[model samples]
Target: MEPSSATVAAYSPCGSTAAVCRAVAEGTGLAWDERDLARGTRPEPVDPGTLVVLGAPVAGGAVPALGLERLGRVHTAFSPCVLVCAYGDRDPGHGLHDLEAIAPGLGLVPVAAVLAPVRHVMVPALGAGRPTADDLAAYRSFGAAVASALRDAGGLFDLAPPPLPPASCPRERLELGFTAECDPAACVGCGACAGACPAGCIPADEPYLTDTARCDGCMACIGVCPVRARSLSDPARLAAVRERCVAGWEGPHRPRLVMGA
Candidate 1:
């Protein structure tokens, strides 16, 4: 049967995953709707034969819990959905597993998966910036491949489920430290940090403070500040941030599908 309307949704704190999904949908000549879960938006209902594609950035080695909860609510209605988890250079092991664990409960079947890379702000010295020309090309290729897979498969592909045999690797923890030291003396109460933070962890007001619990450690605010006042204590903090951000990630991995659950 010809598919019903398609929805391209994402819960990206940094907009990387959403960009990739939108590009893929456009390239495939698919008319899709976007639902940003980060803004408290829910996925719209899909008609019979409709395809649903969901994407999210792998933060702290997992799809944020909020995204999973929303997916669960609409799982029964959407079957054969594709899950894309965007990451930096690290493996996406635990993040993919997290996606799988949340999907089954919602009754959505996993079809194709991809561990695409996007430029992250963790370590500026480590080539963190907008996706390079090569990066964009690679992501475009991956997107096209996924579009083809969906068209060819007609439904969710049967694959092994995730959380495969926990590894002995020690997970890293995000170091909640500022890059550009915010000087209280020279500080202008612009609240730019609060506006720039992707995770919305920074508060808007004088002596702008960050909620470490809510911070994803993306360092976006540091990059956006005009005063160059926010910065990490040293290179050590940068390394710690990188390690912690990719803690549970296995590195460039994808999930297996568990069928007939």
Candidate 2:
């Protein structure tokens, strides 16, 4: 990669991935171009020597579907890239593999992949205010090492995704087919939930309507609703998951850097 022309292509559902992207950019000690996938921007094919940093949270045991779809539209030819997957304290399901799967098609060469543990938005009780000081330190330290290696090797960080833990995620979580509903009686019609729906499943005109067919069940509405009126259908069952997953997280999980041969 041309040391000065690196770029970060990112899709951050709750900002953890975005933070990780920026940390890596800082480590490169160069100016970086950023592309936000939510806006439907397809990144242009990068130059042969350009370095790319890819980032997103692990969702539904994979990279966010929409983000991956948009990224796939960008076709490049052997552009070096680093995959960064941020997840709520638990292991990052299939995120690294997801990025690796897309890299070849997108003209990105797999040079390295990093996993950064972040706060869980679903259950704030677990890993709150995470990607903490220690986490950032680890990320930057790894980033600097990768950058140095890339420079030393004349624009090559070619590395395979590390051997990650078995996904072992819940079947329900894997589907992500759940829909969120708003209790109009409890809703103040403040439009917070509607505006917060990432998939645009909520209608602004009605303010209380959620198109179940369009909802991807990201649960963003549940967190942003000030009135606390939005909820998934099976709250009782999912709550059990939150408790158990959080209790078992066993933190002090740091960021990782995997380099290729």
Q: lDDT per residue, candidate 1, 1-52, as tens digits?
A: 2234456666765567777666555544556777765545444454534555
Over 1-261, each residue of candidate 2 has an lDDT whose tens digit, in order, gives 455577777777556787887788777776678776654454556656577888878766677777677566556566677788888767677787777878877878767778877777666666688878777777777678777777777545444444544554642337744578888899888887776666777887787788988777667788778888888877787788787877787775667677675
Distance from true location, Cα of 4 in model 2, Å: 2.6
Candidate 2: regions farther than 4 A off: 41-48, 155-173, 188-192
Error of 1 at 99 (Å): 1.4
lDDT of each: 0.55, 0.72
Q: Tell me, what's the RMSD of every candidate?
A: 5.6, 3.0
Backbone clashes in each candidate structure, one number apiece? 17, 3
Quote the positional error of residue 203 for candidate 1 in Å: 2.8
TM-score of each: 0.66, 0.84
Give me the overall lDDT of model 2.
0.72
